[model samples]
Target: MFFKRPTKEVERERNQRLLEAVYSTKASWDHARETERAVYEANVNSELHYRSRIQEQKFLYLYKIARKFKVHGKLNDGVIDR
Candidate 1:
């Protein structure tokens, strides 16, 4: 038996629903991608800040040690600036 053809109104409603579903899926994907990119950038910035802080600490420690040795006259090799 042949199936009856759908009316124009029914066909239009179906097409509208399909288009809405497609647009919704695309919007969700776009939002997810943007969020991921933002998170990645924040992580990179945090890591760089951490490394710079560590480097500064190292320099300060070295400077303190060099000064202590210089005061004792035990660093005649002049490895660090007087």
Candidate 2:
């Protein structure tokens, strides 16, 4: 490609354009990183909520089973106590 020698004004304009482009790119990258961080935190919160619910359900199930065994007097090797 044939290239002409860059004049002072032309070089200044080109540098300005490059600087602006770099600034915009950096700003966009920063915004993207912030968005990603927010999404990650939300996902973590949701996962913890789900886990807590699952644990609560499991506790309730165990409680019901224990109550059933106690009422029927079927826990362990047992002589039926009326």
Candidate 3:
């Protein structure tokens, strides 16, 4: 029979260390993912804000152009006697 070297207690200690290392690594990756998601959401919001501003400007410009072409009624005829 082959003789095992590491005692059960030593094996348990080593496995605990490895488990802690893996847990820390996962936590760091989750933090990075959350940060990236926040940045993407902010970028989308800024783009939408810019687009709304541009649309408002275009509407104002069109209103001005339409006002320029307005027609005024002329009252040339005097009151008619029945």
Candidate 4:
């Protein structure tokens, strides 16, 4: 049998369903984007924290070396001046 043309009410319902599907899809996409951004920001923050810790360790190591040099330099200077 040939299919009958859809009635006005049926067409309106179909359109409404399509609009709802589109809105839900858009909402899902927006949520996914927001989650991705959050994850990226977290990764960036973690990397920065790691770099800062490395810098601090390097500074401390250099400071210790400088202190040792200063102590030895003073001793050498005292011997030379005597």
Instruction: List lDDT for all candidates, in order.
Output: 0.53, 0.52, 0.51, 0.52
Error of 1 at 47 (Å): 21
What TM-score do all the candidates reach, one by one?
A: 0.44, 0.47, 0.42, 0.46
Q: Assess candidate 1 and give its TM-score to the true structure.
A: 0.44
Point out where model 1 deviates above 4 Å: 42-82
Q: Which window of ten consecutive residues has the lowest lDDT sum in model 2?
A: 69-78
Q: How far out, in Å, is residue 75 in model 3?
A: 89
Residue by residue across 1-82, what tens digits does model 3's lDDT show? 4887878788667555554444454455555455556676666546544544555555455445434534222332554444
Question: Clashing pairs in model 1?
Answer: none
Regions more than 4 Å wrong, model 4: 43-82
Model 3 segments beyond 4 Å from truth? 1-4, 41-82
What local lDDT does model 3 show for residue 68? 57
Tell me the deviation in Å of residue 26 in model 2.
Answer: 0.4
User: Model 3 RMSD to the real structure?
Assistant: 34.2
Model 4 agreement with the true structure over 36-57: per-residue lDDT tens digits: 5667755654654454455555
Alpha carbon lDDT of residue 44, candidate 4? 52
Which candidate has the highest TM-score of all?
A: 2
Could you give candidate 2's per-residue lDDT for residues 1-82 as a string of tens digits?
A: 3687878787667655554444455455555455556677556546544544555555455446445434232233444556
For candidate 4, what is the TM-score?
Answer: 0.46
Cα RMSD to the true fold for all candidates: 31.2, 31.1, 34.2, 32.4
lDDT, candidate 3, at 58: 51
Q: After superposition, how far is residue 20 of candidate 4 from its true place, in Å?
A: 0.7
